[model samples]
Target: MRKRVLDVAEESFQARGYHASSLGDLMMAAGITGGALHHHFPTKKALAMAVIEERVAAAVEQTWIAPLLAAASAREGVRSVFEAVAAELERQGFVRGCPLNNLAHELALADPDFRIALSGIFSTWRQALADKIASDQQAGVEQGTDPQRFAALAVAAYSGAMSMAKTAQDASILRDCLAALKPV
Candidate 1:
């Protein structure tokens, strides 16, 4: 029941901004009573936080972390991550932007709790990429690259590309971004 509620809330929150989505809407969408919702999540904020921590974080883990971890080189890992995401976005017709970035844009300034939660996820993602870069540096794959700076740049570029794709409703923006990421 808890997981069901979370699943509904995650979809709702992603489709509609957190502030715009109310408990009543969630109850209706989830087909649950107010009491049932309150039983699973004491408040809407709690539900949003759970969606971020669980659903959003897990999405990043699957799309970014796992592939990066499995790659033989940081360059390959980063390229593969971008390619996979680009392909998926192209398939989906680039309808929705990244869930984390969407939430951050909606709630980062308006709510401190949400900002903290989203920031933590971004930090974890950046750190994961940085760790891979650091490993590659040690292995002499990336000699002059600064792991932290490069990681930050990559995240920024990807986030910007996603935003542009969503605005344009064009998956080619993502494909172009992926092409730009390739080494000369």
Candidate 2:
């Protein structure tokens, strides 16, 4: 029941934009009625918070962190993670863009707390990648670059590149941009 609301909310927020999406619309989409929706989420902002938390956690674990952990070593993991990001962008046909980045652009400044929450998610993700990069170098699996800066740049590049790609509706442009990245 709770998951249903979160899922519906995530999709709604993603598609409709938080400001544009109404509780009335969400209610109809979710097949949820009145006080029942309020019982689970007292306010639309609370529901947005849940959506942000869940989506960030899922993306962090599945997209960056998981790949970083699963590969033969830290370097392979980090490389695979970026590759996965590219693959995902390509798989989306360069149309979907990024879920977190999209929301941050749309709602972050308009809502201060939402911006902070989104900022935290990005920070956590970058730090996690940085740690992996450091570990890889320390473990001698790979040797090169300042892990922290590299991680930050890599994450930034992925987000910015995806946003641009989404704007152009060009997957190859994203691929070209990603290919230009080297630890610098």
Candidate 3:
């Protein structure tokens, strides 16, 4: 039941901003009563926190961090991730944008806790990419870039591209941005 609530809430918050997803609507979507919902999450904020900490963080880890870590080079990893996302978005025929970015845009300024949690995810993402880039540099697979700076730029570029893609409702913007970055 707790997992169900979190899953539903994560999807809901991603689809609709946290402020717009009322408790009643969430409850109905989750098919849980007030008592059951409150038993796992004392408040709507608590539920949102859980979704941020658990669902959102896990999504980032699986989608970005793990794949990058497993790739042969940071450049290849980032390019592959962007290509994969663009392909998936094209296949899905909808641009919902990056989940973490969506939440950050909506909630980062709304609450300190949300900001902290979202910042942590972004930091973790950047750190992972930086580490990969550093490793690649040592192996002579990459050169002429600071890992940390490149990682930050990559994150910012992806976030901005995703936002633009969402607004334009076109995944090609992502491929275009990736080409513009010429990421290394």
- lDDT for 96 (candidate 2): 66
TM-score of 1: 0.95
Candidate 2 local accuracy as lDDT? 0.76
The clash tally of candidate 3 reads 0
Model 1: residues with Cα > 4 Å off, grouped in runs: none
Clashes of each: 0, 0, 0
Q: Give lDDT tens digits, candidate 2, residues 35-151.
A: 889999999999898888887568777877777766766545655655666676667664666778888899888888899999998888888878877777787754767878877
- Across 1-184, the per-residue lDDT of candidate 3 in tens digits comes to 9999998899888888799999999999899999999999999999999999998899889888888998888888888789889999999999988989999999999999999999999999999999998899899877888999989988998999899999999999889866875644
| Candidate 1 per-residue lDDT over residues 61-111, each given as its tens digit | 998888988998766777787788878877876458889999999989988
Candidates 2 and 3 compared: the better one by TM-score is: 3
Using TM-score as the measure, name the better of candidate 1 and candidate 3. 3
* lDDT, each prediction: 0.85, 0.76, 0.90
**Which wins on lDDT, candidate 1 or candidate 3?**
3
Say what the RMSD of model 2 is.
2.4
RMSD of 3: 1.2
